[model samples]
Target chain A: MTTQTKQRRKQALLHRTGSYGKGLLFMLPWLIGFCAFVVIPIGWSIFMSFNKVKIVPGGFKYEWLGLQNFRDAFLKDNNFPVDLITYFQEMLLMVPIIVIFALMISLMLNQRFPGRFIYRALFFLPVIFATGQVLSELFVQGAGEVPFIQQYNLETIVDQYVGPELAKTVMNVLEKVILILWYSGVQILIFIAGFQTISPTIYEAVRIDGASPWDSFWKITLPASIPFISLNVLYTIIDLFTFPQNPILKYIKENMIKVDTGYGYASAMAWIYFGFIFILIAVVLWLFERTMRTRRGRS
Target chain B: MLLSRLRRITFFDFALVLGFTALAAFMSLPIIFILNHAFKPTNELFLFPPRFFVQNPTFSNFEQLFLHATNATVPFSRYVFNSVVVVTMTLVSVIVVSTMAAYVLAKYRFHFKQIILSMITLSLMFAPETVGIPRYLIISGIHLNNTYLGHVLPALASPIAVFMLVGFISQIPNELLEAAKIDGASHVGIFARIVLPLSVPAIATISIFTFQGVWGDVETSTLFMQDETMRTLAFYVNSLLSGLQNSVAAQNVAAAAGLLMFIPNLIIFLLFQRKVLETMIHSGIK
Candidate 1:
């Protein structure tokens, strides 16, 4: 290359970098706040997770435990391993149900109906009052269960069909199905928002092409919403992981404050929880890619 | 689809209406139950297995709650005062700081932009409760502990706010911004005039969620404020849970307090819920 061309390329690079620097001016306030509040604390938490933490005057005294804290969580603790398994099972079942239900509600809301505005608002109303404390309080008062389940002796029948182990999870879901559906408020709203990407003209064209609602749903509506479906899946997973009533989190919190298992053990469990969430996301993303690639090839 | 000429009702319509009403009724159960519990007399509260609704309603529980609040050492009103100041400051800062960053991420071509956005998104998975110890240390270390600033600053690092803002802001037409620039508007001018006004739905959503989260948050109070007077009403309300754990009368009083606390959230939602639907297009998919 000529010297002039090289100089031109260098100038282009410098201009790109300089323009990027302009964005930093707007981001400075957030950077300063995030560093103090998010970055340093997360660093300390990760550091603490490796060492045995002791409470002392004025500061925490740390003893290096390396991977021992992590080991102890699985082998030493009684409830954690069992809780993790059940929690995973619960999430795997719940995420799909919530997302599908949200899609249906959003689709129904998308159609013009009498009192649609009222229904939309009514659907999201649960989110305002659905805090962990209120729900736990309600559960304590025995208001969350499916009353007919016990009245009709369905558990015995469920146990007979599904066997004892899986029956427990199924029965738990049945009892809290209404409560579980409450978690879909945000997801439904997201789907509703996502419909803006698909224009009415396209639907009109499909209708003119002799397409039925079911055909259009499979061909256009579902494809157009694949992007949103993945987004909701991730949101649902993260929300479920951090759910206030999560048994695993409760275990981690209890252990953090307890005398025997300190911050180290608790942090270790939290990291494991993060890992589970990350892996679940990765698998779903891979599935989405594989399906998309096949669809592209077929087309 | 409903823009069709015929105003027709089919079998599917009946099933859909029936299903929607059934689910709506189920969803409203907790709201009804909470309202009923708050009004129930002490005898009704102590009923075995609990009644779904109030049999003998009374206002005595609410009166007792008022008495309890007035009787506290710090007085409930003081906590409310502290929270008002903190919440106002926190909301302003949270919106200003988050939107400024969000605007850049959405519209700018910067190095490591994707990396920065992903990091902010990933932090959503880290619940506030999980980082309690480290946050406590950082707060005390910076000499912000026991101050009102500490109460407000932790919630400043809100990723969801920024995430949603960026998603909504990305939907704004690039040509409009170019036009603004051609008209001699600066970066801040275009944002103030064009971006902020257009993104009201997202702002409404952010404000509603932020208000609800901060209004009921007891984490900051528990970690930072050693003095009772410096804490918030939420802290006081939560403390009531553990303090009067065994008393049946306390349960009635607690239910009343809970209802009173929930009224603000309800009001905030009702205020912004119309725009909240319009805001949800931020699927974070783009």
Candidate 2:
């Protein structure tokens, strides 16, 4: 090789060595766990999905059973389909309600007001309190018997005496929204964090143009926060799906106890469910990206 | 006319503030409700009208929770201990590993830098629940089931921390690291003495998130630790509720137990609230 070529090759080797050395060293710990726990098992499960797994005295033995698990869950199992539909339906209602309510409270919390910090803490209290046990207990005890509601009931009793059915209807609406409102605290915090990132100068400029608060909110605040909203939507989906009371999770946990069913099939079923969620997330990300681009283009 | 206009703005402000205050109160009522039920006297808790506050409050329930917690049958303390050990181990492991990883990701002009970082970002979409069943089978097959190492080993490499810290560290000027190198500091030396100290804000952020995560996590503990003594606090609290929901007194006692479990998280929040919140706001800004 020419001297220049050799020199260039030497420099490239040094660069590559430094880069790979540092990168691998940094990733080593995570790579160890990931390879052992995540990558290998994921590959194993895919393999196991096509096999009949049997437990013997020594360990698990397997024989090939192509596509049967998938067939059973999809074609034969009636309950899986029912549970899947119900879960999606619940997600549809729950996600929107959480977003809107969280947005409303976050807007309110963003304003300078007395006891704002206390309110913030109070809102965060649900996060501290929403233990698996606590949620189960709250559901069983009924919201009426759940302490602070008892006080609200006293106020409603007075309202009932004054205007009966109208008051009842109003209170009922509040009650219907109560269970969900417990969890919106994190969503509110996230939104407020989003709102605070908006420069005050934007609102000031909008006001100079004689825009109404409503106009400023719609044109400025809402559009500015689309990114945060998308994030909140993703966070909420993950949170709600994993909630202790989520019927599908509860059902799966119940079935795990029976031990007659093989782990291989259960794992395959889980992967199939995960595939749906992956597609949903992809669609949302694509839509968000497109909207963000259009907005930037307009500006 | 000016007075009327001024009065109108003031009125609007007052109405707006009141509406927010009321709404905030409304939002917090359920949590407050849970707290009250958790602490109230047995008879008062069960009255037809229900009690907002106990006429005569008592700690017998809390006492019962603590007393029974260590019993072999309940394994409550064992669960608490397991949670503490696992969470602490995970927190320490993730911090050390992610810091090193993030330092390289931020500082080095490595091959596939963009691809590697983006891959880490993509991993966040795969929720723990989605991967949990396969994880369980793996743990069981490996004979790590019901073992402490089993619980701690799987989560040692948390992607969220790596993503967060990489973002935070990237903001640090490269000039700082170059200065350290000019002083003849080795990469490890610079990281230990310089990078970590300067990265306290990010460290604080990662710590709170990881701590809260491990504290409140119920699912992983449920999946991995089925042995009575191997259960985490979340599992114990869950088991206690179903096992002890018969009487008002027992329910209150269980609630007190639940509240006891919550105290540590509350304390952690109080201690690190400002730093953690600032880091969270900054980390989550994008």
Candidate 3:
């Protein structure tokens, strides 16, 4: 290469690096936070999961006992494994229900009906209230659940028809209806937002072709909303897994504060639970991609 | 699609509205229940069948809450003050940091841009429970425990906010930035003059979400703020529920406290509902 060309290329590279430096400077706060709060803590937790943690005078002391904590969580202890399985089972049923409910409500609310603002406000109100400790207290006080079951005698009727285990599951699902509805607030908002972005011209064209509303929904609306559906599915799974009411999370919290159970075991349980979440998200993403590809092929 | 047909209100529309209104009523029932309990006299709180409406609404519960607040070792107003201070500080910082980072990610061509953006997105899926213990250790290690910085710093770098802002900023036409650049505007000058003002709707939307998220947070406040005086309203309300149980007055007080914690966010939501919904729709498109 000529000397002039080489010099120009070097200057371009320098300019690129300088701009990259500026971008990094803009991102400095998030970098520091991600390192201190997210990366460091995750690394520490992984390290802690393999050891025994003890509270010392100035700080914590760790003694390495590699794989023992994981073993205890998987094989030695029963509660963590059982809780993890139950959580997965519950999420398998709950995630789809929450997503579908949100979608349906958002569709309904998307219509330009009278009192739309009121309905929207009512639906999104829960996002403000039904979070963290307040939700637990509300459920405990029977403000959200117990009264409905008692008012209709749902427990007795369901128990009479099903076996005890199935009946218990049925009752639990029934009890969770309110909580599930509460969880749909953000998803509903997202779906409604997605619905708004669907251009009216497409619907107009579909109508000119003599398609009915249902036909238009399947052909136009659903196809356009596939991205949002996947987003909502992933979001629902994460929300369910991290919910304050999840038994596995409650178990982890209990262990963290208890002297006997200790932090190492709790961290191990957290990692295992997180693994289940990762798998669930991966499965959902895989399913979503397959559906998208088939739709593309068909179209 | 049906929304475009304003002249025609069909049977399906009526049914849809009716059904959704019923659902909305059911959703709002808990809030209504809390409001009722907040005003009910102590004697009527535990009545059989749990009355949905108060027989005789009174201010005694609220009065008692104020009385307790005034007499407590750490005054109740102190919690409110702490919440306002922390939320305001966190809100301003989060908006500035997330906006700056998001602007660069959206507009600039830089090395590792993809990697940094993906990292932020991935961290969104990391459950707070998994990070709680280690985060606590870090906070204590840095001697930030019991300080507002402990509460504000960790929360200022929310990945979700960054994601949403990046999506919004990406929509701003490149031609606009190019024009500004040609006029001798530096990066900061363009960001401050063109980007910040143009991104008001997105900023407002994120600010509302951030405010509500930080305001409603209790676990972090409880973890970091060992001193009662430094706790937020959420911590105060949670403590009220857990510390005092079974007493009718306490239940009423707890209900009142929940209302106290809810009012600010409620007003904010009412004020910014349109902007929030619009920005959310815009972000969802991306």
Candidate 4:
């Protein structure tokens, strides 16, 4: 090679090596944490899923049961299927309600209006107020105020409007779902931000081309916001399972309190639950990827 | 014709704005309802027509909330303390660690770099919730339960934080780093003196969001901090409401407690509203 070419190659090699060293240094913390915490714990749980953990007064012991826990949770534990179904049913309604509301709010916030900032903040405030325990308190206390109503058993107009039957069903279904609206705060903010990022020029172009506001939204805003919508959907799905009031979580907590068992059964059950969630996530991601690819193709 | 077309657009804008305003009001009604109840007398709180405004607003509810904060059973103050410590520690650790990792990822062209970047991005979708049981087991085994380290340490290794910093760091021109390098600056020196200063805004954005996430999270801390005193503000608020549902005043106190727990996040949101909103948008985008 020519002297100039070799000299340039040497410079490139030095620069590359420097960045490599820096990257390795930077990644070390996450690498260490990921291995120590995430990957290993997942492996441990997979292993423990096959075992029965017995905790004596002083220490613990593990014996391989080999799918016994899974069988127990699925075939033996009658409550497991019911809890799983009820939980996903909540997800079915909650996810769509949150996404639609958040999208509508995002559209509104995107407009120029009086008290917009205050409205935005108010909408967002529930995220802070409606945290797990806090919202549970609110739910409990709010439900408590109806004691006299419950005592008198008022069959008032409002009761008829909300309806005792539907309300009870909603409460049953939403045992953990009502508090979920609070989570819309982040999703709303994200959608608004996404809406904001869509260039005004695109809207203007559509307008000049004689497209109506609805048309522009269909053509520009909605299309552009697809990626953000998918993200919010994913976030909502993950968050729904973490509700403290989740029957599965309650079951686990209840198990933890029992004198004989020390998180072994809970661990086994949780792993199964997580395995289902992983499959769901993979499907959702695949669907999102396909949708995006199709959208790109159509464009 | 042009005036008519413009008029149609204006009409559409007006209708759209009005429709959205109505929707916004409906969505915000729950918050407004809660706030109104929080400030009202217990009797008035449940009154017909559901009084939008509180009559004879009292500090009693707030006073009771603060009073409860002192109690050891709830340890509301300790919860707040735990939240502050965990959030602060997590933010600091995420910034330093993610920045170092991101610097290398952004500036380097190493083998396995693409794999590393993709793994981080993919992991962003996997929240702690999915892996909660295992994580709890891990923390329990390590005896990190009920400590600030348990609350804070896992949050530090966010894939999104690294990804965010990579985006910002990549935008930094190579010549700047090369000049420092030619000046006999070591990689660590270049990162500290050169890369760190330039990436302040990105760091600020990451830190604020990370703090918000950790501060507001009750699940992790609730699961880990079996001790009441070790709980974070979110869990304390939950406990207070759960603990006191009978007394009329206690209901009010619960609302106040909810509002109190909301205060720090509200303040953060207000102070760094633009930063938080912007970072959220950026994070959502990628």
How do the predictions measure up, each by TM-score? 0.92, 0.82, 0.93, 0.76
- Candidate 2 error regions (>4 Å): A1-5, A114-125, A128-176, A296-299, B1-9, B69-83, B109-119, B127-147, B216-231, B245-249
Residue-level error in angstroms, candidate 4, position B284: 4.7
The parts of candidate 1 lying over 4 Å away from their true place are A1-19, A194-220, B1-7, B244-246
lDDT of 3 by residue, A1-299 (tens): 69999999999999888988998898888778878888888898899999888887987889999989988888888787876766676678888899999988888888877778878877877876666655776775777775668788888899889866667667777788988889998898888878877999999998999999999999888988998999999888877776767788888888987887689888988888888788878989999999999999998
True contacts kept of each: 0.60, 0.37, 0.56, 0.40
The 0-to-1 C-alpha lDDT of every candidate, in the order given, reads 0.84, 0.72, 0.83, 0.70
Q: Candidate 2, after superposition: displacement of residue A162 in Å?
A: 28
Error of 1 at B241 (Å): 1.8
DockQ of each: 0.60, 0.39, 0.57, 0.33
lDDT against true structure, model 4: 0.70
- Candidates in descending DockQ order: 1, 3, 2, 4
**DockQ computed for model 4 against the true two-chain complex using alpha carbons:** 0.33
In model 2, the clashing pairs are none
- The candidates' interface RMSDs, in order, read 2.0, 3.5, 2.0, 4.0
Cα RMSD to the true fold for all candidates: 3.3, 5.8, 3.0, 5.9
Tens digits of per-residue lDDT for model 4 on B42-117? 6775677556668888877877777767655565666667777777788888888888888888887767788877
Q: List the residue pairs that clash in candidate 1.
A: none
Give the best candidate by TM-score: 3
